[model samples]
Target chain A: MTDLEAGREALLDHVEALIAQRGGVSITLAELAAAAGMSPANLYRFFENKEALYEAVAERWFAPKVRAMEEVLASDLPIRQKFYAFYARRLGMICDDYARDPALFRSYLELGQQHIEIVRGFIDLADHFLAELIAEAIAEGYFPGLEIDSAVSLVNLMLQTFCDPELVVMLIHSVSEEKLAIVVDTIFDGLRGDRPSNVRRLTRAAR
Target chain B: MTDLEAGREALLDHVEALIAQRGGVSITLAELAAAAGMSPANLYRFFENKEALYEAVAERWFAPKVRAMEEVLASDLPIRQKFYAFYARRLGMICDDYARDPALFRSYLELGQQHIEIVRGFIDLADHFLAELIAEAIAEGYFPGLEIDSAVSLVNLMLQTFCDPELVVMLIHSVSEEKLAIVVDTIFDGLRGDRPSNVRRLTRAAR
Candidate 1:
C-alpha cells in the first residue's frame, strides 16, 4: 500500500483500539490522536470528526460481514442450513467479540444509535439479505401467509433481544447460542410450510 | 373516604396530570404539590419521594392491567383469543398513551429501567400469566415441543416490539393496531396446534 493508505489504516486501527479501551465513543479527538502518535490536524485530514471516523470504521469492520452474509445466501446449502450457517457465524463472532472486549462492542452499538444513519445503512444491508432468505422460505412453504416484508418484520421483532445492540447490552449476561438456537428453531417451526404439495422451489438453493 | 385518604388520591391524580402536561417524569415534587394545592412537605406526608409516587402510579395505573391480564389467562377463551385479547388491550393502551404524551411514556420506561426491581416485579407478574397461557396451548396441541418457559420466551421475544414500553416509545408514531394484529396473528398461527384433531380444549369463553 502507498504511504497515505498506510496512514489511513493506522488511523482506523487506532480508532478501534481507543473505542475498545475507553468503553464508549465519548473519547476525545486528542486522545485518539495521542493513541496513534499523530497530531489532531493529521487526523482531521483523514476524518472531519468522530462521526465520519466512525463511519469509516464501520465500513472497514462491518461491511465485509454483510458481504459474507450475502454469499451465504447465494450458497448451495438448503434453506435451513443456510440460516443455521449464518446464525452460527454471527453468534460465534458476537460472543467472541463480547468476550474479548464487552465494552467496545457496547460502545460500537451506542455509537451506531448516536450516528443512526450509518448504522441504519448497515442494518438495511443485513435486512436485504434476510429478506431474500425469508422470501425463499415462504416459497418453500414456511410462512405461507406472509409477504417478504412482513416476514422480515417478524424476524426483526422476534430477534430484537439478540439483534438490538441496546437490548443485547441489557441481557448480555444471560445470552447464549443454545437459547438463540431454540428461538430460531421455534420461529422456523412457526414458519414451516403447512402445504408441502404446493412447494414452488424444487431445491433449497443457496444461490 | 377519610380526609387524609382523599387528599392522597387528589395528589396522585395531580401527579398524573402534571406528567401528562409536562410530557415527562422530570417534574419536581414541589411543582406537583403546587398543582395539587399542597406543599412539598404535605406531598411527602402522602409519599416519601418521587420514585415512591411513581411506584404508586404504577400500582394504580399499571397493576390493574396486569391483574386484568391474569383474568384473561384464567378465562375459558381459546388459547389464541386469550393471546389476542392481551395483545389488543396492551397495543391499544400503549398507542393511546404514547399518542397522548410521548415524553411521559418515554420517561416512564426510563424510570422503570432505573427502578428495575419494581419493573422486574411487574414483568414477572405479566410473564406468570403469559406462561400459564402458553402452557395451556402446549397442552392443547400447539407448540408441540415447547415447554411453558420456552414458549413464554418466544412470546416475549416475538411481541417485544409491540409490548416493550421503551420500544413502544421508539416506534409510537409508526404503530397501528392493524400491524400489531398482524404480529399477534402470526404468532398465533405459529402457536396453532400442529395437530388440530388432538385438541383437548373446546371452549373459548370471552369472559
Candidate 2:
C-alpha cells in the first residue's frame, strides 16, 4: 500500500484500540493523535474531521463483514446450509462488536438516519449479496412466483432482529442456534413456494 | 370506582398529558402534582415514586394490547388470519406509541433489563396469547412434529422486529403491510410442516 494508506491504517488501529478501551467513540481527535504520537494537525491530514474519522471506522468495521457474506454466497454448499451460515455469520460478527464495545457499537447504531450516508454503501453491498442468493434460489425454482426484489426485501425485513445492530444487542442473548435454525427453516418453507397441500386440506377441513 | 381509584386515575391523566406535552417522562413529581392541581404529598399517595408511576403507565398502555390479542385469538377467523391480525395489531400499537412521542417511547424501551420487572407480567400475558394460537395450530396437525413451546418461541423470536419496542421504532417505517404479509405467510409455511416433496426433488436435482 502507499505510505499514506499505511499511515491511515496504523492510525485506525490506535483509534479502534482506544474506542475499545473507553467503550465508546467519545475520545477526541487530539486524544487520538496523542495516542498515535502525532499532532492533531497531522491527524487532520488523514481524516478531515471526527465524522470523517468515524466514517472510516464504520467502513473498516463493516466492509469485511460484507465481503464475508459475499464469500458465503459464492460457496458451493447446499442452498439451505448457505442461508443459515450467511445469517449466523452476520449475527455472530455484530454480536461480537456489541460484546467488544457496546457503547461504541451503540453510538454507531444510534446515529440512525443521520449516519446513513457513512454506511449506505456497505449496507447496499450486503443487501446486494443477499439479493444474489435470493435470485439464485428463485432461478433454482424455489420461491416460485415471488419477484426477486420483493422476496429479498421480505427476507431482510423478517431477519431485521438478526441484522439490525441495535436489535442484535438487545435481543441476541435470547437467540439460540436452535431458534435461528427454526427461523431459517421457516424462511426456507416460505420461499419453497405455497403452503403444503396437506396443510391446506387440513385447514379447510378444520374450518 | 372507589374514591382512591378515581383520584389515582385523575392523576394519571395529568401525568399522561404532561408526558405528551414534554415528549418524555422527565417531568418531576412536583410538576406532575401541580399539573394535577394537587400537592406532591397527595401525588405520593397515588404513586410512591417515578418508577411506580412509569409502571402504571406501562400497564395502562400494555394491558389493552394483551386484551386485544386475546380477542384476535378468540375470533372464529381462520388460524392464518388470526396470526396476521395478532401481529398487525401489535406492530400497529407500538408504532403508534412511537409516532405519538418518540422520546418517551425511547426512554421506556431503553430502560431495558432494568425495566423488566414492570413489564414482565404484560410480556408474559402477550406471550401466553401467542402460545395459545400456536398450540391451536399444532393441535390441528400443523407443525406436526414440533413441540408447542418450541414452535411458539421460534415464532416469537422471528417476530422480534415487530414486537421488540426498540426495534419497532427503528424499523417500523421500512415495514410495509405487504412485507408483514410476506413474513406471516412465510411463518405459516414454516409452521405447516416439512419441505414439500416437489421442492425437495427440485433442490436435489439442482445439487
Candidate 3:
C-alpha cells in the first residue's frame, strides 16, 4: 500500500481510539488531527470533514466483511453451504469486533444511520447476495414457488439480528456463534422446501 | 382504582410527555413535578427517583405485551397458533408504540440497559413461555428429540428482531406485520421436524 494510504488508516485508528475512550464520536476535527500529530489542514486534505472521516472509518471497518462475503459467494460451495458460511463469517467478525471495542462499533452504527449513504453500499451488496442465493435456491427446487424478492425480504428480515449492526450490538450477548448457526440452519430449513405439504404457504406464489 | 392510584398514573403520563419532548429522560424531578402542577415532594411520594420513574415507565410500556403473551399462552389454541399470536401481538404493539413516540421508545431501551433488573422480569417471563411452548412442541412430536432449552434459545434468537426492544426499534421498518408472520412461519418450519429424516439433527437429543 502507498504511504498516504497507510497514513490515512493510521488516522482512522486514532479516531476509533478516541471514540472508544469517550464512548462516542464527540471529538472535534482539530482534536483528532492534533492527536494524530497532524495539523487540522492536513487532516482536512484527507477527509473533507468529520462526516467524511466517519464515513471512511465505517467503510474501513465494513470492507473486510464485504470482501469475505464476496469470496464466500464466489466459492464452489453449494448454495445452502454458501448461505451458512456467509452468515457464520459475518456473525463471528461482528461479535469479535463488538467484543473488542463496543463503543466504537456503536459509533459505527450511529455513523451509518446519520449518513445512510455511508452504509448503503454494504446494504446493497448484502441484498444482492441474498437475492442471488434465493434465486439459486428456487432454481434448485428449494423454496419452490417463492418469488425472489419476497424470499430476499424474508431471509433478510430473518437475518437482521445477525447482520444489522444495531441489532447485532443489542443481541450479540444472547445470540452466540452457536445460536447464529442454529438460526441460519433454521432459515435453511425454511428455504429447503421442508414444510409439510399440508402447511399452506402464506407468501405470494411465484409466476 | 383509588384516587391516589389515579394521581400516580397521571404523573407517569406527564413524565412520559416530558421524555417525549426532550427525546430523553433528562428532566429534573422539579421540572417533572412542575409540569404536573405538583410539588417535587409529592412526586417523590410516587417514585423514589429518576431511575424509579424510568423503571415505572418501562414497566408500563411492557405490561400489556406481557399480559397479552400470558393470555396467548393460557388460551386453548394449538401451540403453533399461540406462537404466532404471541409475536403478532408483540410486533403490533411495539410498532405502534414506536410510531407513536420514537424518542420515548429509545429512552425506554436505554433505561432497560442502564437498569437490567427493570427488564429482568419481562425476560424471565418470556423465557418461561418459550420453554413451555418448546416442551409442548416436543410432546406433540413437532421438534422431536430437540431439548427444550436449546429450542427456546433458537426460537428466541430467531425472534429477537421482533421482540427485543432495541432490535425491534432497529428493524421495525424493514419488518412489517406481513414480514414478521413470514419469519415466524419460517421458524415453525424449522421446529416441525420436516427435515426429510435424511439430514442429521445438530442439536442434542431430548432424553
Complex DockQ per candidate? 0.19, 0.36, 0.31
Question: Per-residue alpha-carbon lDDT of model 3 for A1-207, expressed as tens digits?
Answer: 897788888898898778777765456789998899999988887888877786787788888898889898888776666776678778789888888877777877765677687678778988998787778778887776568887887777667777776767776666765566566666766643334322223222211
| Sort by lDDT, top down from the best | 3, 2, 1
Cα lDDT for residue B8, candidate 1: 71
Residue by residue across A1-207, what tens digits does model 2's lDDT show? 998889889998998778657654356788989999999898888988888887778878787687779788888977776777778777878878778767778766755345677777777877888888888777777787778777777787777667767666777667655556667667876754344433344434655
Q: With candidate 2 superimposed using the best TM-score fit, by how many Å does residue A163's alpha carbon deviate from the native?
A: 2.2
Off by over 4 Å in 1: A20-22, A25-31, A173-175, A192-207, B1-5, B17-37, B49-51, B173-207
lDDT per residue (tens digit) for residues B17-109 in model 1:
776675544666888888888778878888888777777777766865776687777676666667766765777777787778667777676
My TM-score estimates for the predictions, one after another, are: 0.81, 0.84, 0.83
Give interface RMSD for all predictions.
11.7, 6.6, 5.1
Docking class of 3: acceptable
Clash counts for all predictions: 4, 0, 0
**Candidate 1: how many backbone clashes?**
4
| Tens digits of per-residue lDDT for model 1, A1-207 | 987778878888887887777665566678888888888998888777877777787787675577678777888766765665565456556666667877778888777767788878977888888888888878788777667886787677767676665766676665555556555555666553333311112111211
Look at candidate 2 and tell me the lDDT of residue A67. Answer: 74
